[model samples]
Each structure stands twice: as C-alpha cells, then as structure tokens.
Target: MTVLTGEMLIGFSAVRGQAGEQRAFDPATNAEIPAPVFGLGDEAEVERAATLATKAFDAYRTLPLARRAAFLEAIASKLLEIGDALIARAHEETGLPRARLQGELGRTVGQLRLFANEVREGHFLRATIDSALPERTPLPRADLRLMKLPLGPVAVFGASNFPLAFSVAGGDTASALAAGAPVIVKAHGAHLGTSELAGRAIQLAAQETGMPDGTFSLLFGAGRKIGEALVAHPAIKAVGFTGSRQGGLALVRVANARPEPIPVYAEMSSINPVFMLPDALRNRAEAIGRDFADSLTLGAGQFCTNPGLVLAIDGPELQRFLIAASLALVAKQPQTMLTQGIHAAWQDGTRALDALEGVQKIAQGEPVKAQCNAAQAALYVTDAKRFLADGALQDEVFGPASVLVRAKDFSELLEIAERFEGQLTATLQLDSADHDDARALLTVLERKAGRILVNGFPTGVEVSHAMVHGGPFPSTSNAMYTSVGSTAIDRFLRPVCYQDLPDALQHDALKRGNPLALWRRVDGVPLQA
Candidate 1:
C-alpha cells in the first residue's frame, strides 16, 4: 500500500490543512479505509492558492510555447513513473477494477502528451493579421493583429466518476496549462488518495521543468464551502467542472455572482438518447438489444454518456427487441458503484422511474449475495406521448438503468427527438432501408446534441480533436466549448487584437516577417513564413 499523507498542496509546498478530517470508504465493502484521515481545506487555503496562482499567471503564461509543452510532457512522465501505485490506490479508493484504472491512467497521460503536441503546433493561437490599407478609397486602415491569450488562473473541480482521466491532472488541467493558464484543482473527496498521488506528480513536474511554483495546486474538502470559496475568488477567471446538474449550476451561479464574472464550462447532465429506425429494428432487434444492454451496464452505468433513454417505433419488431433486451438485462449481475452516495442516488433514481405514471418496469438484473453498494441493471418502457407529457422521464438516472420509449409511428419518434433537451450525444441505429427516416431526423439531432452517431453506442467517448464532449444548456453550461480533446484549450483562452502596434511591440506570432514561423491569416489570406 502506498503511504497516505492527507495534506493540501499549495504550489510546491504541502501544508497540513486545518479544515477537519475525512476518511475514504471502499464502496465494494462499505467500510472506511484504515488510518490516514485526509485533511480538509478551508477558506484561508483557498485564498492562498488563488493568490499564488494569480501571482504566477504572468510568468507561467508568458513562457515560450516549447517550454510549456515540455512542462506538460514532464507531468505525463511523472504520472507514468507512479503508474503502479496510482492504479492500486485508485482501485482501492474507487472500487473500480485494476484494468479500468490502468486504462484511465493511460488516457490521462495520453491527453497530456496530446496537449503538449497541441502547444508545439501553435495553431491554437488563431493568429490573424490585416496590414494597414493606407490607399483605401474612403479611409486608411490601421495595422491589426488578433490571437488568443490565456484567461488567468482556472479552477478545476475533480469528477467523482473518473478518478484519473477527469480528476487531478485531467482534461481541464491539461487544456488550461496548454493554453498558458495556471490551474488550481479542488480535489474530489471521493478519491482523495488518488488526487494526492496525482497532485504530487504535478508538483514534481513543475519543479523539474522550472515552472512557476504556483502554476498548479490541489486543495481538499468534502463540503461545498471550499468549492464555493475557490470559485468566488476573484483570481479564478474560469472554471472546469464535470458532475451532477445541481452541483454544476451552483458553481455557475457562484462564478457569476463574483465581482468580476467568469466563464464556467460545466459538463453537467445528459441522457445521451438513442433512436432505433424501423428497418434496423426489424432486421437485428436481438443484436441491438444485446448491445444496448451491454453499453447501459458498462461501468455500472456511471458514465456521463450512458444511454439513459431509447426511442423506437411501436410494432412487433419493437416487442422483439424489448424481450431480447429484458433477458440480457436480467442475466447481468449487480456491480459496485463509485461510492455509497452514488449507489444511494442510483437507487433513488430507479425507484422514482418505477413509480412514475405510464412507466413499466420490464426487468432487473440479478442481485449479488452480500454485495454492498451494488447497482442492478433495470429496463423500463413507456409510450412517446406519456414520455413527452412528463418532463420527469427525461431526467438522467445516472446508473445501470434505461427507459425505452415506444412511439406510435415515425412522426411520433421525430416529435420525441424534438422534445428532447440538449444531450452530449444522440445515436441513430439505422439500416440502409432507413436512410430516408435518418435523413429527416438528422437536422433536429444536430440541434439537440454535440455528437451524432450512426449504429454506435455513446458510452465510450474517444479523446481526439474531432470529439465534442459538450452540448447545449443543462448538458453543459457552455455548448461552444468541449471538455475533452486538443480543442478544449479554447475554453481558457480569449481573443485579443492589437491595432497599429510596432513590430517590436507585437507578439511574435502576429509580428511582421513571422518571427515564430507560424501559420496566420494575413490580409484575409492564409500564410506561413
């Protein structure tokens, strides 16, 4: 077992926090881990971290792009160095299997390397130039240059579901650092041990790369006070969050209420709806049913992109698919969720679904003997009219449960799609014969979701430039930004334009002669020099 030191990391220094103590629990066993109660952070610590980050922002943001890239690479290297210990601690703290933790660790580091490459590429700057038009018929134009710059310090809240890939040193931190902004993380209480381990790696990386001391910091607290304090701090210019809709909205409100408002990119709730076209359902109902069960039950259905709602046209084919899906769900055994609170919430959600009018519980997964905090898969069905009438049906269940809505015809199915709130992903399971129906549905789905898939599940989100792990409104506070991939750096950046500045006074990427050899839009034409 790795030695546990429950302390707050402010810059390169570890301080014993004065804000109470808390212990981690093993959800699989429903027992608290022995010894090493983690220290919680308080308002003072939040102020200190934010102040230090504000001080470091100027130096850290102005570092040459290559040096910043190296800093990200260094963090990745340090994480790899402690990979074994991280996996073990994560498994113990999260009740997630060793294999899952290993994969998540890989994703965590892979993203860091990807961001390092993005920093080196320098295209994220979005450099543009318009030379002086002194010979214009009406009036002369000033030399203008535009590019993105960092938005000061950022506050990243660790996610409970993903201890590595979405926790400390996760996408938010990686992208913010890649965009030349300092980061201060509010560690998730559910995975304090994992956060500590990852935080140490970041500190070491910053030190080794000669980055500013306050470039990164990690604070711990189980309550909302610390999070609220961090967000309310004037130094935090932006926020990155992934959690329940209620929590995300609360943070957004706090950030807005600050004397100087800031952007809060919160990846909140989403059901990630899937539609089954008629021909496809008739052709491979059983296979699609089986696949749906597998995807819904994956990770005990703790994924943000879990297919919580499925829409299909009512017919004999739909009945066949439901039967196959129910059987597959019934055979599944209960799996442990991340924490007791999460397990309790899952139970509450499923119970509410069962009690809703016009909703029928079709089947439930087998229960494991003496297993604590286990989530049993459940399947439910209701008509499209009833579903559309009841807003409660659209709420995310956040577990191994899915509701299948049976529409009377293609028109009703499209109506259901139109009624849906913003979603992270919307999937269409269609066959060649269903192309016309799919084409009709495409426009509405494009407006409703950030990503639309054909014949695929939404549970597995790929980390790449093309990925958009975001959606409109409640799905995410701002749909224009993504929480994953290289483009995520855009969230922590804001465009700035310089007018009539001398070459020596302008940024290298915007200066004449292209000192940085960057690609930019010069006088409305793309150029590289």
Candidate 2:
C-alpha cells in the first residue's frame, strides 16, 4: 500500500492545508479506510494556488504547441506508470468494481493523449487572416488576423461518481492544459487518496517536461469554503464542474457574483429520457425492456446519462414492455452505491415517488445484505397527463430507478416531450414505419437535448469529435460547450482578433510566411499551407 501525505499541491510545492483532517471511506464496507489523514484546504491556500496559476499562465500559454502537447502526453505516461496502485486506491475509495475503475483509468489517459494529438494538429487555434485591400475601389481595408487564445487559469471541481475519469487529472484538467491554461483542482472529498496519487503523477509530468512551476495544483476541501474561495478569486478566469444541479447552480451563482464574472461550464443534471416508438415497441417490446433494465442497473444507475425517464404510447404493446421490464428489474440484486449520503438521498427520492398519487410502483429488485450503502433497482408507471402535471416525476432519482410514462396518443407523447427540461440526451427506439413520428418528435427534441440517439440507449457515450456531452441550462451551465471529446478544449479558449499589427509583433500562426503550415481563412477564403 502506498502511503499518502495528504498535502495540497500548489505549483511545485506541497503545502500542508489548514482546513483540518479528512479521510476516505470504503463505501462497500461502510467503514473509514485506514489511510493518511488529508488536510482540508482553506481560503488562504486557495489564494496561493490562484496567484501561482495566474502568474504561470503567461509563459505556459506562449510555449510551442508541440511542447504543450508533449506535457499532456507526459502526464498520461506518468499516470500509467502509477497504474495498479492507483486503481486499487480508487476502488477502495469509490466502491466501484476494479474492472470499472480500470476502464475509467484507461479513458482518463486516452483522453489526455487525444488532447495532445488535437493540439499538435493546430486547427483548434482557428487562425485566420485577411490581408489589407489598399487597391479596393473606394476605401482600403487594414490587415487583420484572428485566432483563439487560452482563458488564463481555470478551476476544476472533481466529480464524486467518476473518481478517476472526472477527478484531479480528468477531462477538465486535460482540456484546460491543452488549451494553454493553468489549472487548480478542488479535489472531491470522496476520493482524496486517489486524487493525491493522480496529482503527484501530474506534478512529476510537469517537472519532467520543464513546464511552468504553477501550471497545475490540487486542493482538498471537506466543504464548499475552498471551492467558493477559488471560484471567487480574481486570478481564476473560468471554471469546469460536474456534479448535482444544486452544486452546479451554487458555483454559477458564485461566478456571477464575482467582481469580473467568468464563464462556468458545468455538467449539472439530466434524466436522459428514452422514447420507445410504437412500431419498435410493438415488434420487440420484451427485448427492449431487458436491454433498458440492463442500462438502468449498470453501475447502479450512477451515470449522468442513465435512462431515468421512459416514454411510450399507451396500448397492449406498452403493457408487454412494462411487464418485461418489471420482471427483469425484480431479478437484479441490490448493489452498493458510491456513498452513504448518496444511498440515503436515493431512498428519499424513491419514497417520494412511491407516495405520490397516480404513480404505481411496478417492481423493485431483490434486497441484498451489504456492509455499506446499497441501492435496489426500482421501476414505476404513471400516465403522461399525471406525469406532466407533477414536476417531481421528471426529477432525477440518481439511483437504479426509472419511471415509465404511458401517453394516450402520439400527440400526448409530443406534449410530454415538450414538458421535459433540458437534457443531455433523448433516445428514440424506432423502425421504418415510425419515421414520420420520429421526425416530428425529433423537431421538438432538438431544442430539449444536446444529443439525440436513434434506435439506441445513451448510457455509452463515445469520446469523439461528433459527440456533444452538454445541453441547455439545468443540464449544463453552457450548452454551447462540451466536457468530452476533442472540442472540450474550446471551453477554455477565447477568440482574439489583431488589426493592422506589424509582422514582427504578430503571432507565428498569422505571420507572413505561414510558418506553422496551418489551415486558416485568408481574405475570406479557406487556405491550408
């Protein structure tokens, strides 16, 4: 077992925090794991981290793209070097299966490499140039150049659900660093041990790559004081977060209240509704039910894209689907959740639904004895009208549970779709015959979700250029930005246009010789040199 010092990393130094001692818990055993005591960071430490990050941003952002890319690759390599020990600590802290944590670790490193490739490609800079048109008929146009630049130091809030993939050196940190911004992470309390290990890997990578000293830092906080202080600090320019709606909104409020408000790209909440078209539901109701059950129970319904709401028209086919789904759910055994607080919250959400009028508890999975927190799978049924009337039905339960809504007709289904708040994804299970209805529903769904799936579930999100892991307000703070894929780097970047500047003062990307051999828009036309 690797011993942890639990000190906060600020620049190249590890300082003992003043917020007091905290420990990681084994959710599977419901016991405090015998681990090193972690120091909770306070306001003063946040100031130190913020100031260092701000100072480092200048030189770090000006480094060649290749060097920046190399830094990211080095971080990925270091993470892999700490492989087994990191995975074990993550498993103990999150109560996630070893296989699952292993897979997440792969994703975490894979994304870092992906970002490196994206940086070297150079297109992300969006360089453009329009030469002066002094010979034009009436007036002359001055030479103009444009490109995106980093948004200074960024603050990333770690997520509890994905200890490895969304914590310390996760997507936010990778993307921000790739965009040439310094990063200050507020580590999630649930996995401080895991976070400390990853932070050390990043520190080693920074040192090995000869990057700026304050390029990265990790802070611990048992409560919101540290996070609040970091976000409100003047040195911090932007924020990236993934958590519950309440937490995201709170950060948004803090950012908005800052002396110079900054953008907060938060992946907050989503029920991720799945719509079953009549033709498909009628043709393979049983199969769809079984598959849906599997997705709902996978990871104990901890995924942000979990199918928490299911929609279908009322009929015999719908009845068959519900019956099959209930049967599949009942056979599943209760599984451990991430924490005791999460399990207790899940129970409260389920109990609230069970007590609501016109909502029927279709079935619940078999109970299992566990040393710690566990959640039993559950399925509920309710009419579309009743569901639309009661706003609580649409709220996410954050566990292995889902609500199936039966609409009277296709029109009612459309109305139900319109009632949905913003979502990360809205899936459609359709066949050839359901094309027209699918088209109609799609028109409405386009405004309600970031990603629309055809004949598939949303649990598995592909990390690629085409993926959109963000949505309108409530789902995320900014729908225009994503927290996944190559484009995620855009969140930490801003465009700057230079007008009539001398060649000597211009950036190399916009220089006369086209030194970087980048793709740019020249004189209102596309140019690749």
Candidate 3:
C-alpha cells in the first residue's frame, strides 16, 4: 500500500503544511480516517506555489503540442493504474457507493484523454491569417495573423461532491493544463486523502513526461484565507472554482480587487428546472413522475444539474403526476450525503422550506435509522403564484429535495420560466400536440439556461464537444464559456494577433507554410491547410 503523508505538492517537492492539520471523515460512520492527518497550508505556502508556477509558465506554454497531448495521456494512464486503491479511498472518504466512485474515476481519466485528443487536433488554437492587401484600391492593410495563447498560471478549487471528476485531476485541472496553463489546485477539505492520491498521479506524469517543474501543484488548506490568497496572488492570472454561490463570489471579489483583475470561471448554485407540458402530462404522467423521482435521488441529488424544480399545469393530469411522483419518492431508501456539513445544510434548507406558508410537503423517503449523514428524499408542491412571489422558494436545497410548481395555464408556466434567475439546465416534457406551447417557452428558456433538453432529466451531464454544463449569473460566473466540454479550454486562453512579423519570427501556427496544420481562417474563409 502506498501510504499517504498529508502534505502539499509544491512543484516537485512534497512539503507538510505548518498552519493546521485535517483528517478525512467518513460521513457514513461519523468517524475520521485515523492514519493520515493532512497538514493545511496558509498564505505562505500559497506564495511559494504561485511563485514556482510563475517560474514554469513560459516553458510549459511553448512546449510542442504533441508532447502536451502525450503528457495528458500519461496522466490518464497513471490514474487508471492507481485503480481500486483510488476508488476505495474515495468511497471511504465520501460515503458514496463503491460503484459510483469507480464510475467517477473513469470519468476523471476520460476527461484527461478527451483534452489530450483536443490538444492533438489543435483546432482550439483558432489560427487565422488575414493576409496583407498591399495592392488594395483604398488604404493598404497590415499583415495580421491570430492564434490563442495561454493566460499563465491558474488556481483550481476542488469541489466537494464530484471528488474525482471535479477535483484535483478533474475538468478544471485537465482543461487548464490542456491550454498550457500551470495549475495550482486547492484541495477540498472533505476528501484530503483522495486529493493526495490524484495529485501524486499528476506529479508522476509531469515528471515522466518531462514537463517543467511547477507545471502542477496541489495544496491542502482550510477556510477562505488560503483559497483567497491563491486567487489574490499576482502570479495566478485566472481561476477555476466549483462551489456555493457565496464561496464563488468571494473568490470573484478577490480576483476583481487584484491590481490586474483576472477571470474566475466559477460554477455555482443552480436549481435546474423541469417542465411538463399538458399533453405529455395527460399521456405519461406516471412514467414522467417515476423517472423524475429516480433523477431526484440519483447520487443523493448532489449533482449541480439535479432537477430541483418542476413545473406543470394544475389539472387532473398534473394531480395524477403528483400522486405517482409522491409515491415513488416515498418508496426510495435514504442514502448518505457527501459530508456532515452538507447533511446539516440540507436539513436546514428542508426545514426552512417546511416553514413556508403556501408550500406543502408532498412526500418523504423512507427514514434513515442510524446512518450518520444519510438524507431522506423530500418532495414539495406549491402554486406558481407562490413560487413566483417568494424568491426564497427558488433557493437551492442542494440535496435529494425538489419543489413542484402548479401553474394555472400555459401563460403561467411561461411566467414561471421567465422568472428563473439562471440555470445550468432547463428541461421540457412535451408531445406533438404541445409543440406550439413548447415553441413559445423556447425563447424564454434559451435566455434563462445554458442547456435545454426534451423528455429527459438533467442529472447526467455529457462530457462532449457540443455539450454545455454552464449558465448565466448565479449558475456560473461567465455565461460565455462551458465548464465541462472541449470549449472549456477557451476559458484559459486569450487571442493574440501578430502583425507585420517576419515568417521566421512567427510561431508555428502563424507561419506561412502552416507548420501546425491547424484549420486556418484566411481572409475570413476557413480552410484545412
């Protein structure tokens, strides 16, 4: 067994933090994992990590694209090599099922390989050549060529829920590294052992692939002070964060307050809403209701894209749907949440919902006997008038809890959709008969959410090129980029236009022979050269 020594991976060195110590706690047993006590870093460690990343920036970004892609693939291979030990550690730490951790490990490595392929393709560079027009009738134009460049060192904050897929070697780390930015990850407090293992995998890959020292570093820290210090550091040109709205906003504020403000791609709070059109409700209410219940409780509804709100017309069909949904929810067995803090937050949120005047509890899952951080699924119902009136009703409960809204008619449904602040995903269940109504709601939903779906739930986010796992405002800091796809690389890249440079002086992408072989837009026309 490879023993874990709770320490920070600062470049090529593993150094213990001096500020404090933390141990991973098993939410299922309500006990701490005793062997490895992680030492937490403070502002001093932050400075050292950031400085090393700065030292490594230029060499890392200018490496050959093939080597970069190979480096990513090496990391993926190393993770798969870690195998069962990784899954066991994650399961023990998170209280999630062993099967789920196994699946997430696959996802984490899959992301690395995907970004690896992305690097090989070189399309993300967006190389363009607007040739000089020396013989133009009017004024002659200057020779201009453009391609994207890395934004220097980045700070990634590991998330609590998807420890593998959104943590140390997760999408944020993978995408930023793919874009040639040195990454410094602040390991999430809940899963310190898990972070250490994955960070070691990355460190090994970097060294074996001959990547520059400080290309990656993982830190263990407590509270916002250390995290804020990373965001506020001068060397960190950008940040990628996944957490609560308050936490994300805090980093955003720090980044903004910096002398040279940088972009913070933060995936925050979202109560992904689902809509059931009248015809669909009339036809398959029971089926839709059952599936909704399953999605609501999947992974204890810890997914950021979990369907937290449902909308439908208030009629006999809707009532039928509610009955089916309530019965399905009531039959579900309670499951353990990610942490004690999350379990407590869920309790507080559900209790607060219970106190609301117009909202009514429709159903509760089978009670947990003595399981430590277990959460019983909850379902609530309220009218559209109440849902729209009380902004408190829209707050995300962050667990296996959902609110169903009864809209009087199509107009009221549209009103509720328009009222949504922002969402990661919005879904619609409809038949051909409801096409017109669905069309009317489409325009509003497009503006309100990043991804839209038909006749399906939003719990499973696809990690593909075209898929979008982001949204406006509270859902994500920037509505322009995605957090879980090929386009995610764009968040860490900035376009640079070189003008009137000699062919020998130009980078490979902008050279006259097109050495990189990237698809180039020449004089506004795209060509494969």
The most accurate candidate by TM-score is 3
Tell me the spans in candidate 3 whose CA falls farther than 4 Å from its real position: none
**lDDT (CA) for every model shown?**
0.92, 0.91, 0.93
Where's the lowest-lDDT run of ten residues in candidate 3? 1-10
Clashes of 1: 0
lDDT of 2: 0.91
Give the higher-lDDT candidate: 1 or 3: 3
- The residue-level lDDT of candidate 3 at 239 comes to 94
- Residue pairs in steric clash, candidate 2? none
Candidate 2's TM-score: 0.98
Q: RMSD, each candidate, Å? A: 1.1, 1.1, 0.8
Per-residue CA lDDT of candidate 3, range 1-529, in tens? 4568998999999999999988899998999999688999999999999999999999999999999999999999988988788899999999889998988998899899999999988999998889999998789999999999999999999999999999999999999999999999999999999999999999999999999999999998888889999999999999999989999999999999999999999999999999999899999999999999999999998989989999998999999998999999999999999999999999999999999999999899999999888999999999999998999988999999999999888899999888899899999999989999999999999999999999999998788999898999899999999999899999999999999998899989889898888788999998997
Model 3 lDDT, full chain set: 0.93
How well does each candidate superpose onto the true structure, as a TM-score? Answer: 0.98, 0.98, 0.99
Q: What is the lDDT of residue 370 in candidate 2?
A: 50
